[model samples]
Target: MKFFDELKARGIIDALSNEEELEKKFNEGGMSFYCGYDPTARSLQLGNLFTIITCMRFQKAGHKPYMLVGGATGMIGDPSGKSEERNLLDMETLKENIDAIRKQLGLFVDFECGDNAAVLVNNADWWQGLGFLEFLRTIGKRFRVNEMLNKDSVKSRIESDSGISLTEFSYQVLQAYDFVTLNKLHNVSLQIGGSDQWGNMTAGTDLTRKMNQNQVYCMTMPLVTDQNGKKFGKSAGNAVFLDGSMTSPYKMYQFLLNQDDAIIDALLKYYTFLSLDEIAELDSKTKNEPHLRLAQKSLAQEVTKLVHGQEGLDAALRATQFFFGEKIENVSDADVASIFEDTPSVELSSEMLNEGGVIDMLSETPLFKSKKEVRRAIDQKGIYINNVAIEGPTQTLSKADLASETALVLRKGKKNYCVVKFK
Candidate 1:
């Protein structure tokens, strides 16, 4: 399929400037395109993955992808989607964030693919040297104050309690200059970003045209959200980060796997490269047998494998299976710790276990309300020690019951599990 056609098919292109000219340029091939990522944090979150995927799609189509880390702009945050001003990061923190983000981008895009190898550029390289007066004369002169005031980002902030700052108000000018610089340095003519970045992106195209007297292109993908309209990249008020250190592969898998059925089709389009036929099949399964969660599992697997590789996906699957009645004997200690990281846990001294049977131990922890509740659950065949049903209150955790040498899995029922770590 043609590049634009594929983008439309995948629901990646929300809006683009001068589609006819861009299509012609794309058909000719070897077009260098870029998407900017601000290092506001140490790692890119799930929210940033769509743009990265878009870059990958362009690269696969034989276009050169430039992943721009916004070291210059990140210092003065983009006010695109925020209701309030962002706290500026110190230079040291911004540099650390840039280095970390650079490493994460390396995992997704090929940096050594011969001719079309992806390139990483820091906007700081050029912006750092440019003087304020020079910037005002050269780039800032192109932007009209009235036009900047009319932009959605600027207009909304101007009407709000916390009005926009001069630093942030001039952010569009800096971003526009980025496109101009890339065009001059790398022959890059296309810029892609999220729908929220439409104004900033078009400003870049405008600046390029005004400066070089040459037309450029800009495209944006829709912002992805869950069924309830919350953005897809967050869980329990925290971002689901792409860096494993920030958010573990198992947690990432579970987050995707537990998405509402109503949004799975859209997520399939936005997140995965699964073809229309495959996604259609999964959609059909979702309709016919929602209980199977075929779509959710596929979404989780595809995203997890993409971000964390096969081994990480395997670990996620193993961790998930272990909780759903799978035997715990084969799982490693590290796997056990990872799987139950969010589940309730109780730590007991080795000497404490010697003083009590299973019921007595259960009573001591928050797992059970009382000794009576423990006995009741045990009698009802709802209590399990390491996936084996505890027959009576007489049953005690023996050393052999420990999955590792130090831990035991306790289950009150099918879904509820707690880890008892013997210190």
Candidate 2:
């Protein structure tokens, strides 16, 4: 399949400025394109991952990628997807976020490859030196208020209870100039963004045409949404951040692992670099044997490894094993905390270990109601301390049972887990 055709086939390309021309250009040869991200938070959300992967798809097809960190535009706050004005980000936070995201983006695209290697840029690099008056006269004059007012992003804000700010109103004009700048600097011919940013993207194409006399193009990806059509991101409910600290590898793995079968295919295509044939095989497995959850497992593994490294994937897999009643070994207190964050927990004094055997201790907590209940569970080999069934009702507690420094993982069965923490 042709490059553009395959993208459409996968539903990667949602809107294009000119389909025929863009398709021809895409097939012709290696060209330069760009995608922008704003430093709105300390870490990029899963929604932004869609754009980064799209850039990778183009880069693989022999195109150069210019990843523009919206340092300048972020200061003004793009009104594209907002129902209300966003609180402006401070310089310190924005710079910190930009640096953090730069490292994350590098993991996906090759920076060492020769001509088509990825290049990172900050709009602040250009905007920092230019004075306000020069910006207005040079780039601002081209955008007319009436046309800007008609843009869906702007129009929606105008109709809202809190009207758009002048700073936000000029965000499109600033972003539009970014295309011309990239075109002048890197000979970039195309720009891509999420569908919600179509208006902002078109403004860039139009601005590039008028300012630089370059027929640059814009394409938008449909918002990476859940099956219910709600936009997927922090605001969508769960803040599935790419950063490990904000959202643990276990949580991230669970998010993808629990994806609905209805959208599993699209999730696989969008989130992973697995080939169409590989995805097709998974799709078949899903239809024929969804009870196995092979597709969800693959999707979880691929994305977790991509965002986190091999070690993180291993950690997520280990975390998964733990939930299924595997013995916990060599895991840290923080990891243990993350694994059973949502499960019930029973805290005990470190002194209690000296007073009780395993059954005596188990009976004290809510894992079992009484000593008799605990003994019966042990008789059936159904009770576990750190995933090891008690040898008998008389099994004693010891320091060796602690999975971490001060925590012991307790479970009644495969699904019921409770953490026993030493106070």
Candidate 3:
């Protein structure tokens, strides 16, 4: 497929300027395209996932993808899609955030080789040294205040009860400047971003055309959302972060694995590099036996491997096995720790287990919320020690209760499992 055709097939093209001309330019090769990322947070969420993926596609198709880190612009937050002006990040903090984000982007796009070799650029390089009068007289004159104020991003904020600040209101000019700088210095012709960024991206295209009389292109990708129409990053109120420190690989894998049948196909197309045949086959299997959840498993596995590594993928898989009624006996202690590191656990002394019955131990951890629930589950043959169901809450702790001499896996039911460790 042609480069842009593939993008459209994958639904990555939310909007693009002069589609015919841009496609022709891409076909000529060595076309420089860029998408900017502001460091609003320490880590990028799922909303940013599509843009990075699209950038990769452009690179693979023989176009250079410049990943712009808004080191200078992030200090003045973009007003797009905001109810109120944001609190600015200090220069020290913005620099740190820019470096962290650059590292994250490095994982997605390979900048070392090929005609489509990716590169990271910071606007701070140019925006930092410009004199106040130089900026006002040169780039600032290209934008009209009347036209800027009428943009959707500005208009919505202005019409809201919370008024906009000059810092945020001038955000478009800074963004437009980034585009013009890239176009002149690096010959960057294309600017890509989210749908909400259409206004800012076009502002860049227009600025390039007016200032340099150069034809620049712009494109955006739709927001990655769940079938329920809600955003996709939240895992029970906590976001699924790309940074392993923020969200562990095991948890991140599980979040993708738990995707409902309704959204798996669309997400696979957007997130994974799997061929259409493979996706269609997975889709077929999913429709045949929705219970199997094979597609969701593949999605989780692929994404985990991409963000984390093979070791992280293995950890997530091991975690999945434990959830599928498997025991911790054959698993390594390190793997066990990596998986259940976040699940609540109570460290028990060996003597403590010896002194208390199963009921007392269960109650001590507050696993059941009450002793009565623990007794009821045990009486109903629902509670398990290690992987085997318990007959009664009165069962005494024996040597068999400990797994690998350090851990105990308790199954409250099919879904709820707890791990207890011996210090």
Residue-level lDDT for 195 in candidate 3:
83
By TM-score, the better pick of 1 and 2 is 2
TM-scores of the candidates in the order shown: 0.92, 0.92, 0.86
Give the least accurate 10-residue stretch of model 2, judged by summed lDDT.
Answer: 230-239
Q: lDDT tens digits, residues 11-106, model 1?
A: 787997988887777766799999999998899988899889878888888899999999999999888877789899999999999999999999
lDDT score at residue 334, model 1, on the 0-100 scale = 62
Candidate 1 lDDT trough over 10 residues, lowest sum: 229-238
Per-residue lDDT for 206-303 in model 2, tens only?
A: 88889889888989998887767777776556668999988889889998898889999998988888888899999999999999999999999999
lDDT of 3 by residue, 1-423 (tens): 777676777677887788788777766668899999888778887767777887887787788999999888888888877777677777787778887999999999998886668989999899989998999999888888999988999999999999898889989999999999999998999998888888898899899999988989898888677656765443224477888777778888888888889889988889999887899999999999899999999999988898888988986787677767766675555555666766677777677566468887888774788888888888888888767777676688865667556778887777676778776
Residue pairs clashing in model 1 are: none
lDDT of 1 at 346: 85
Instruction: Rate residue 196 of model 2 by lDDT.
Output: 86
TM-score of predicted model 3? 0.86
lDDT of each: 0.86, 0.87, 0.82
What C-alpha lDDT, on a 0 to 100 scale, does residue 158 get in candidate 3? Answer: 92
